[model samples]
Structures are given as structure tokens and as C-alpha cells.
Target: MKTILKNHRRKVTVYLGRRDFVDNSSTTEPIDGVVSITYRFGREEDEVMGINFSKEMQLVCREIPLKRDVKVTEMQERLLTKLGASAYPFSIDIPDNAPCSVQLFSDHSVKQ
Candidate 1:
């Protein structure tokens, strides 16, 4: 499924679903699904005059639905049923002053 965020400073709902996976192991486990929003500034591997600058930031990171069970809405239920899968619904709210998506390149010599 595809989800588009029209407003960068608004809350967005997300749905995560998974089908069972079979492995040739005696142990069986169900993996928990999670969603995360992270921001990285500067280059961690790049250095200028032996000085490196990098920042690790996280806005939101948590398991889907926050609970251990799946609680879907009516619309979500219909959608999941049509897709032939079970899903967990969750929401992520972006701060009011959150930065909008941007892409920057240090290689000015490269053509766009």
C-alpha cells in the first residue's frame, strides 16, 4: 500500500500488515513491526581537515499500534480483508516546526 503525506506538519496514519513466513527451524516467532522517523545532518563518514560533523536525530520511533494486538478501524478492516491480510494501524504526528523534506548534494560538479 502507498501513503502520501500532503502536509509535512500534520499527523499521518499508517497501516502495517504481514503474512506468515516459513523457515526450516525448530523455533517459530512472529516479528513485531515498527515505524520510525529519523533525520540525519552532515556526513558521518566524510571529513574536512580531519574534522567530522554529523548529527543523529529521531522524531518518532515506536512499534505499530503501540499495543500487542491489532485494533483496526472499519475502513481499515475492509481494506485489509480485500487485501487478504491482517494489519495494525497507528498514527504519527509531526511537530508544527518540523522540517520539510529536502535533498542536498555536496557534489556540485555532477549534473542534475
Candidate 2:
């Protein structure tokens, strides 16, 4: 899901269905089901001493929907792959200390 971008700011919302499951991040078993995610980006921070913090920030994605057909950053992938338990929502806090970029794969693979 692509968050709508307004001007240079990203302020979009989405929803994922809820489900019941168990912890299996320790195994390779496919947690085959739906996941949820909600991402909110803060306004660009002012540059500091010729260093722009806006370009270097962390993103926290919560209630993000997951799918095997959806491939994300290695970190995100690892998180999803290692998620031990399932609940009403899937949340992830990404420390994107840089320009954040996210792409949702329809076929479940990261675009190369």
C-alpha cells in the first residue's frame, strides 16, 4: 500500500484485517495469513549545521499488513520472518536514520 504524499509530506492511512495465530518466528513455517501496518511520517526537520535531519530519520510502521508475496527491506523481511506471535495487529518500528522509502509488492517479491 502506497501512502498518499501531499506536497513533500506523506500523510496517508490504511487498514488490515484482524486474525488469530501463534508465535513461530523461530521456525520457517509460513505464517500464511494477513498482516497490518500503519505508517506516519513527521514533517521534515530543519537542517542542523549543514546536516539535514529530515534526510536522516527513522520510520515507525505499525499495524502493517504482511504477505509472503510482499518483500521489503532485509530488516523488515527479517522482522516479518522472525515474528514469533500473531495478534490483532502487526506493528514495526523502523529506525530509518535516512531518507525512508517503502514499496509494496503485489506479487510478494522486492522489485529488483
Candidate 3:
């Protein structure tokens, strides 16, 4: 298990973009967007083969901007990549107890 101090900062990139579903035209421009890190998981309670116990569950969720307020000029947007997106760098330190993303078929019935 890797250990991280409380003061350690985790770095991440924030991508900004826009999509128009009406015309099937989509554009993405990396602008300043709010980034947040969260820990998501639940306990698995089950009884199997006369055994009753709970297991640790950890899940990874995709990063989505919770809030956005950046505005870019037309020229800046045009200068963006063909996807019309720019990437902003950010960092956040997570708790040491945070579970790392690991794929384990603890429950054989579910394939993640």
C-alpha cells in the first residue's frame, strides 16, 4: 500500500468544451473549470454458503465539472485544437485512507 501525507497535493488536468446536440456539432475548448476529488464506495453485505460477512467496496467515478465560469474570446477558442478544447492544470490532495483504483472480481457475478 502506498502512503501519502496529508499535505501532498495531487495534480490533474481540467478540460473545457462545448457540444451542440441540435446540429450534431460539438466543440470542446479547455477553459478554467472547477475540479473536485471525492471518494465513493459502499459496503457489500451478503450471506453465501452459510457465511455471512461484509466486504470493502471501492468504486471509481469519471471526473465531471461541477461548476464552470470561465469565458474565452473567439480568437482564443479558434486557437484551440480541432476539438475546441484547452487543458488547465490543477491539483488536490486526497485523504490517505482513500482507496486506490483496483480491479478485483470479489463478486464474480459482476464484471467492472
Candidate 2 error regions (>4 Å):
1-63, 85-112
> 21-82 in candidate 2: lDDT tens per residue?
23344432222222323345665553332422222233443444433555454443444454
Top candidate when judged by lDDT against the true structure = 1
lDDT of each: 0.40, 0.34, 0.32
- Quantify how close model 2 is to the true structure by its C-alpha RMSD in Å: 16.0
lDDT of 3 at 81: 29
Q: Estimate each model's TM-score.
A: 0.31, 0.19, 0.20
lDDT string, candidate 3, 34-105, tens digits: 232323345423223333223445432445443234454453243332223333222233334444333334
**Predicted candidate 1 versus true structure: per-residue lDDT over 19-41, tens digit per residue:** 34233344333322323233346
The TM-score, computed over Cα atoms with residue i paired to residue i, of candidate 2 is 0.19
Error of 3 at 39 (Å): 28
